[model samples]
Target: MRKPENESRTKTIKAMYTQIVNELRARILSGELTQGSRIATEYEIAQQYHVSRGTVRQALGELTREGLLERVQGSGTFVRSSVHTHEAETSLPAQKNIGVILSHATDELNMRLLRGIEQAARSRGYQVIFAYSEENDQLLARDIASLQMTTAGLILFPLSNRSIDSTIVRLKQVGFPVVLVDRYLADMDNDYVVSDNVGGGYRATEHLAILGHTRIGFAYSRAGDLRTTSVRDRWEGYRKALYEYQRPFDDSLILADLPTDAEPDTDLFDALIRRPDLPSAIFAVNDWVALEFIKAATRTGVRIPEDVAIVGFDDLSYDEHLSVPLTSIAQQGIAMGMHAATLLINRIEKHVLGEPKHIVLPTQLIVRQSCGARLQVLRAPDEKPS
Candidate 1:
């Protein structure tokens, strides 16, 4: 029997093989590599990708099975004559697969949701494929078109939250089995699974209000047009909480589009710090934004919760490890994924019949040191670091 070390190695090799297959398939679809044109030999491909000959062979074999590649035994692997053009990809019958399109594949929340989708999909005897949209609308549309050729159904964590996208509308027109995850277009009635962002926002803000924070800032984005249903819902909840607590909503404290993950934008945050009557706490859009606020505050010697309490949505995995563990709203990501996949599979297999279903899961407020509930109060920080 193979040991755990061998199992790890096998998974890595399999991942490498799948990557190679995707890259090669993309080349064929884009006409970069033409049909009936010979590709590099196993040894050459192995060298180019820095993978082993066995891995190259495995990738070629899978493509061959998919009718995208042909092996002449002696001559090298060649693009199949039938596999031409992206539009013509559906020349072959669709596979028993479910495709998931999301913003990022490596994100913790996305990964967790994918685990649930994969669990539900495989248990129903369906294979799952994934494509990343990187939050681009054009690329997301292109991905949906390409994936539909091979997959039985698709689940989208779409790029836009503002308006009804034409691509998704077309899918509905054709009656294609597709489910929207995390966010949905409010105009259309479609199958969707999402967390209760409004409640999550309300809970986070109420927590801060309970801690005696009357001046709470909503850290939204300057890119007002891109705010999705999830973001808008959260903001609505923030407003609701303020009304409930009888706190005045200050428009001046609205921090918009200060990105720190890609490139640090210190001007907005720094300007907020200079305000004479600054907010005592901040409710960030998400954990990424919360972390960015904490980072900016830490840099300027503005303490967390003490100086200004910070709370975020989408309780990410590494929140606890921060210098000040962030208090965040935890969504049922796994359950969301499972529900989405199950719903899509039901449509695919004709197991369920009814109007389109929209499932909204609940959220939990995870309190930690960042909220000043468990740690020493803010004023005790006594001195600022120079």
Candidate 2:
């Protein structure tokens, strides 16, 4: 039966809008559009899909009603912050699934870790679900509770700001198969995997000391405290290296109050400038903070590796491309992720018995131009300028 032109066009438009809505919903389910992330404007979506603005608006409106998106006046639409209500209404498959809860998901380190986990899970025929905690303890607790309903087991990167001791204890009491990664709670009995932070810190400090740096300083972000597992371990390694080198420890050499926010704090640099005697070298807790210190030092006319050498933990990809290539401790994030997944899966399948497994991977030092080691090599008479 042939329909009128107006009726045919109306049906076609409705089909197009329905397709758009389904596509957007699929993205949300696939984790391509994360919670609280901004989505494209109606105009942008219409242009991309070659659809009318009305069609785009209709599609977005439907998603908003379904509790998948929220639109603000004068601002763009965003994914809803909470997915519990949506998940509650949806029917999930009965297939085996593993849940991963991380403090963050966007950074390079975390992405690599996710890759390793996904690779391992795929080989084992298990689906992987991800939840971002943003280092919030309350959010982490909620995510754990939600994932517990559907997933077979769980993997977690514990928050540094607040302890999840009570939550983990509860999970343990329920006999949930769980594995901890990156950070661990001291009093908890859980399978875990972590990098050798103390060894990395010691090696970084020792490298500077070996390079004839007597006055060495330690720099850490204010986001983490001395009680934090990773930070405390690194600091202990620094102290151990100092003792081994017979170097005197000076409290003034520690710069432990750098701002953790995205915006730079000039006052932190001011403290460094006002010091009567600047340290010959600085060991930053991580690569990002090391780069921040470099930027601050440059603003104050302090030349890196000349006036003050610098070393950092975490050999991030961009470290080599920096103005002064950073010397850092290499952490095997991907390996750690794979190991954590293996541990969790084994527990879930009952392949591992008896006590929980705690694995601490080794770290290595990656030397670059920032630590003055390259300068020494270049200055040698037998060495050619590569």
Candidate 3:
């Protein structure tokens, strides 16, 4: 007997589903889908491919597991993050390639630094392979291990909280060419390049003091723990600068654990600023945190520079774009990255080089409208000869 039309239709649907899935997979792998683009939905796909909804769902499920598509709870499906593509490129070459290990690529500071590294690497005929960890100690260790096997040289941004001295020591013992960025292990002999964090912090505070502002606030995440060298250095600088100004350090003015994860906290900032004895000025550890202060202060009807001045580290892209642009300690991210990459490449080329070296770069204070020290808003303060 011949099969019924419904039975034939079922078999046809299965075949069409397979074809659709293969086509979509190919498009994603070839970079055709693109990051942040929405993939076709089950209903749309079912209509287009002449397949049942069940068949479409099955196809999407397979790709989602492979990290190709992401299914949001209520917002519909999207292409999964693009970090895996960087992982795929890690295996390409040794000499012509350099590996950049970062904590988070989505972070503004990290992206700026990576842009610098990419510029220097491309000009010098080198390709960059980037790997990012979510600041997890174990995942960071794995990333470091992967770099050792795949690339010619390594540039790492180490996890801040946990101890990784042993791992750094092990890499050094094996004669690996590594340049640490932003963070460094205590007393470790590994070659590293970092900003003059202490000096930057001191200058930010000293500048506030010179303007006749007392009771300044220092804001940061995990401020007292001193998990990383930068945090410790900044805190030390704050103390030193206050001491020089003959201002008594008040523990109550310091704000810690201000939600540096993903986004800044408004309520926390509000509480800090609402204090009866509010800080005349605040020094933030980075630009993101400074933006938070600006937003929170504005919401509370506080005027920038007039009520509370603000300064930030890492002069970021949007710093100058704000209504009241921010003052910041300008870290030479591109120059630092270029220098670190060149050092690593040099070591890779000179295989006989015996020991690693450390390099510290200088930082500059970029005065802007936010600090109340702008040339136009206030009278000029005499500059001390350098």
Candidate 4:
């Protein structure tokens, strides 16, 4: 006995509705359709997918019931904010598996941090599961969701873009145990371990000043609101150092809007090279940027330490191996990771509670050839008791 045509048609329509629901759910979870953002109207979705309005309605209805979407009386469907959701049940198993999420695991700084995390976790009989977000919000959200289901707790090294604040807040609101590493969201009460970026910046600037390089530029990669807390703190430190040295803080000396890993903005570099009033020295936000700037400057016949000097933060191991050994601020990446991991484990074990703790680790200044400090020392030795 063959099934009725109407029954077959009904099953096909239901499957279409389910497919729509899954697609929308994926968008919401991946942050393509962000929290409180409006989704396409029923007619728009129906027309786009070549499905009936009734099918779209059924898909939206399913999302609404699952607490993933909300529909207002006068407004269209919106992604539901995670704040109103019920508290997530703690589902950590006895295996003591911990999850680590980082922007880039392959980066040297991050690798050092991971080494520390692994050491600490193993010593304490805990296992670690690492995930790389590649600084993508969608990948980060997916990693977070997966970790939430299986790990005892999470240690996150958030991206500098600051797009993960809402997600982090949601996790906190749901009583998820997490410790942030390297960077933190401003005004959010959360556990974090960070380097003393301001002090590092100050040290970098002060070193240049000590080498008689009063005119120093601050070079950064990010522009506008994309600036990270570390960069901001470093800038503050630079300002403070200038104030202490009684040197005028020239706004023109600050050069942001540089190229990022995704977008190559060569114009910014050209502008820096062509600037009428170039600083005698530069304090880069990090070693990588310093290296790039040095390479660019050298190619343009800029004599380092004679025409310009450079200092960088995050005294990476390879800094010394550069053509001109870079002066930098040494951040203890491994220690930071160990501390963050320990903090998370303590929280998971209910050892700490109440107000979230914020740990600011100290930074050290490393003097090298690039900042012209070594030249100053040699010149001092050659001086005949001035």
| Tens digits of lDDT, candidate 2, 1-386 | 55677765765677678668767865764467878889998999999888899999989998887567999888889988744221332244423678888766445566556656766876787767777787777888898998888788898887774444788889999999889988787667788999998999899999988887778888888777665677778888898998999877888878886785678687777557446687888899888789887777777777787778899988976677676789999999889888988888888888997898999999999998889887766566663211
Per-candidate TM-scores read 0.73, 0.75, 0.72, 0.72
Off by over 4 Å in 4: 1-95, 223-226, 262-271, 379-386
Query: lDDT tens digits, residues 215-284, model 3?
Result: 8888888522466787778878888999999866887778777885655567888777777777778888
**3 or 4, greater by TM-score:** 3
lDDT of each residue in 100-148, candidate 4, tens digit only: 8877634667766776787788788786676778777898888899878
Candidate 3, residue 255: lDDT: 73
lDDT of model 2, residue 81: 71
User: Residue 265 in candidate 2 has what lDDT?
Assistant: 81
Q: After superposition, how far is residue 278 of candidate 4 from its true place, in Å?
A: 1.0
Error of 3 at 50 (Å): 36
Arranged by TM-score, best first: 2, 1, 3, 4
In model 3, what lDDT does residue 103 have? 76
lDDT of 1 at 194: 96
Please list the residue runs of candidate 2 whose C-alpha ends up more than 4 Å from where it truly belongs after superposition: 1-95, 161-164, 378-386
TM-score: the better of candidates 1 and 4? 1
Winner on lDDT (2 vs 3): 2
- Where does model 1 exceed 4 Å of error? 1-95, 222-226, 375-386
